[model samples]
Target: MTTDPKSDGGVTQSPNRPFGLPRWVIGVVPILLLGLVVGGFVATTPLAGVDGGEPLPDVSIDYTTLPNDDTIRLHVTNNAPEPVTISQVHVDDANWQFEMTGAGGDRTLEPLESATIEIPYSWMEEYDYSVTVIADNGATFSTTIVAANSSPGLTGQVVWTLTVIGFLIGIVPIALGIMWFPFMQTMSKKWLNAMLAFSAGVLGYLIFDGGFEAFETAQSVPSGYSGPLLVVLGISGAWLLLQAVMDWLTDDEGESRLSLAYSAALGIGLHNLAEGLAIGAAFATGRTSLGMFLIIGFMIHNVTEGPVIIAPLADGNRPSLVHFVAFGLLAGAPAILGGWIGVSTQSPLLNTLFLAIGVGALLQVVFDIGDIVRRTGSIRSAPNMMGFAIGLVFMYATGLFTL
Candidate 1:
């Protein structure tokens, strides 16, 4: 008797089976279809709506800018569950006439919608101003601008200035730090291991530092976005993504010293990007002193990061000049882009997200370095322990200057 080749052990293949698709796809399709059906039903029905008592008027002043000496522009968002009408605006307790724009150029703002208010008032420099917005439902929201100055625009002069600042704080400092690579090569094996431990300590300190900054920045994000949750998601996503990439790059034999060095550079680079954003935001907000302080502090703080990148490769093959240069740029160039974006388009959510990602990257690097320290010797050993402690102390000392 002739038998069909498609039959397996007298069981015939089902004609309904997809020809080229995997079996998992076949299973997933039904789940997705069910989800879509349920989602459509919920969206079409009133089941998605929640009646959380009475609708309260809530609003947030996302940012304020001075377009000219006589103009005070406010970017406002409605965080209420119901639409809100901006009834009036007050500058320094005095009612001011303002022109509304955005959200259909009306005073009424739908839930989670944003609008801009332009008030033609003579705002003095080096002064503090309190701007308050009154809602139609008798709700009020206010924000204070300290030492008010013209917000930086995307003009050529401003861009050039930011570029110079970015180069000074980002590229120059990191390049100086990487200069330690040759010196690291001459250290003894024990000292090399200690340096690796130190790198971990530095990264450990940074993880906390970045995490704190991210959480702090998240507080400024709109309530609807759930800033704290965004930080959590950002950190988790970045950590898992980087961990996967690292795992894919490493072979069964294990992670190479060169790969570890590159990873350290990437982690430090992300941290520097956040620093750039902070500095840029400070400047954009007219906190020149704070910006300068951050510049100096980051320059010093980042110098220590160079050793972290090179310490892993010190005992192994010396990377060529191209690799060293690549490492420096990888660790520093993000600062330039970050500074520009932070100044030109200041978004608390974005800043918080980047900082969270940086924290995650640093966390991964810290563990990777810990593994190296373990292979070198017991991390609890005197030299390694001291190195780690010193790294934390040094970063803290440098960080104090920025604060």
Candidate 2:
């Protein structure tokens, strides 16, 4: 019997079957397409907030006092339209006396208008006095009057020292980020996930706590606290920008050496800038312990950050030693800069804002790194989790969570 060329026994095959899609094309194409879709979604979500431009309160005090003896004078200008009243006034010393002299009893002040209260005291000698004023609306303001200590020399020096230090710490991390990538790609997926999780925990805790605490703290020092809204918006905006960067870095070819190097470095640079500002502000405010605490926790966190940058590069045929060290320096240098900046700035508001931005960056880092861990299929999950727990405990012990 003569059989057809297309048929073997009862089985028939088409010519087009031999040229059909390869197995990898069938599997990998779908996966790549899916990854692209998921990546887009991840990039758009706002992971945290930033700090900028919150309206500050305007407060002024007017008074006349005798030498050595202090008299309290309270004048408040309410920029916001509303009635304001003074509930109580506390003077640093007994030589000072306070009394309401304008508006109504108990020092009632109208919005956009100023009210005056006077404190009369007996003159003794040269002495500096601090005045604490509390308003009925839960606003508090404090000012120090220098009788003999009002030297322009010391004030200028203090301001200069703080300003320089603040700027340095704020930008250091960005510098470090430039070279952090090549090393991160070689880290085990398990360790990367652990670090990522730890970062997320720290940032999440800080965002909820730090953001609210900053606003409350600001209210204590100034009449009108402005900037909380900015903090929230900034966090969202920064997160979106980071998401954009992540999307760009993760595009076709799956995290190349150059893209990994640049994206991580840039993200870290911004992260360090904010960190520096925060540290500077803390030091400026005479909160050395608090500033140190923040830096130490972040530093531990920074060590893990290097690994995150390096691990993604593993797929590119295992990064070389040169790339590893270069990325490490890039990721680490910013921490140094951030540390210096933190030591300089003495502004409480700046610190608050910096904290907000830091929180945002940490969130982004955690999620971005976590994505890598999930894809890489971790082997040492337990040990990596231990590392993450250790990191968290270290942060808690450092008093970073203390308000």
Candidate 3:
């Protein structure tokens, strides 16, 4: 034993071989204790998505303040193929970094999903605030906003809004169609020819509207020409699909006319889908009033669409109730599906594709109607031309509402 004058001559505590423990074991005791401490820390540490820190991709970040609670929520919209990690959320810098160690506090977010991070109001200051998120792979996502103390109206209100705009748009026209076939049945051949031409005119207007929207949507992409190219391809694909159906089915008059009517319905269905998408997107983005207006506008347009769907069947043969219902479902149900998808994913390319398909179907339908009218030998008669003009005017006028 050794004594130290600083310790008032107390016995020194020194290592010796007198104890039972081996020197090698003593050498490793501190190391084992240190390893246990490190292991505990790692076990408790809340890592996002991966065990190791890594970057995440394809995430859209949005920040908004919760006025009632004075808390800020980070909304991360994940659109990647795989799950991603968002480890650290900080404001301004690490000085205002938040601890995200709570259960389900954004450990992992699945593909095409969303997660939220909440930061306390105490951390906010009266400067232009920026929130930065660091992923496990060191990918950083950041956004700037007015200070959290600002009035609530300045921030976006985030809500997952689902709408039935498509169904409302469809039902009006379908109801009108229920009265059409019987009412038109007793009319003379002159009226029938005129009505077919009118329906063709309605289709003519739709082609222009749908084509324009499709091209515009496409031009939003980096490659401006892609929009026009997609339009051409969509038209070609629609024509080809209809042609394939025609070749597979009958060439007989009744069956052929029925097929044509259904084809028109398919075209109109595609067009309505685009409209539904717009309505849904408006609502999804918190534009409730805009959605309502769109529904009203599209409803009027849809009412005219009913005539076009039934035009192919307007020949001498009166269609059964089953046929009317079939056309209605074929044309109208697609809008509802489109609305659902539109609200969930606002994909412009997909919308453009749908418009292009509608273009192809409607254009083909117009030609078929014209062919039928031509066969009647009154393609330019007063009734046909006057009805066509009236139909065209009606359709164009509907566009004036700016819905």
- Please give the lDDT score for candidate 1: 0.82
State which candidate, 2 or 3, has the greater lDDT: 3
For residues 1-403, write the lDDT of model 2, one tens digit per residue. Answer: 7776876555765554422545556667878999998998788755435454444444545222221234344445555555666677766733244677656555666655556667664433346667767766566767775552211222456445544443333323323432444554455655555655554444344445455655654443323435576567556766677677767665665554356444454555545555555544444333344455544455444443444454445445665667555655554445445545544433444555655565565556556655655666552477656655665665465544333
Residue lDDT tens for model 3, 46-105: 554456543336555633443333556665655566776777777778534443432256
Model 2 clash tally, residue pairs: 40
The 10-residue segment of model 2 with minimum total lDDT is 62-71
Top model number, TM-score: 1
lDDT of 1 at 4: 81
Worst 10 residues of 3 by lDDT: 151-160
On lDDT, the stronger of 1 and 2 is 1
Once model 1 is optimally superposed onto the true structure by TM-score, how far is the C-alpha of residue 282 displaced, in angstroms? 2.1
lDDT of each: 0.82, 0.51, 0.70
Quick one: how many clashes does candidate 1 have? 0
lDDT of 1 by residue, 235-298 (tens): 8887888778877887632346777778788888888888778767766776656466666876
Order the numbered candidates by lDDT, best leading: 1, 3, 2
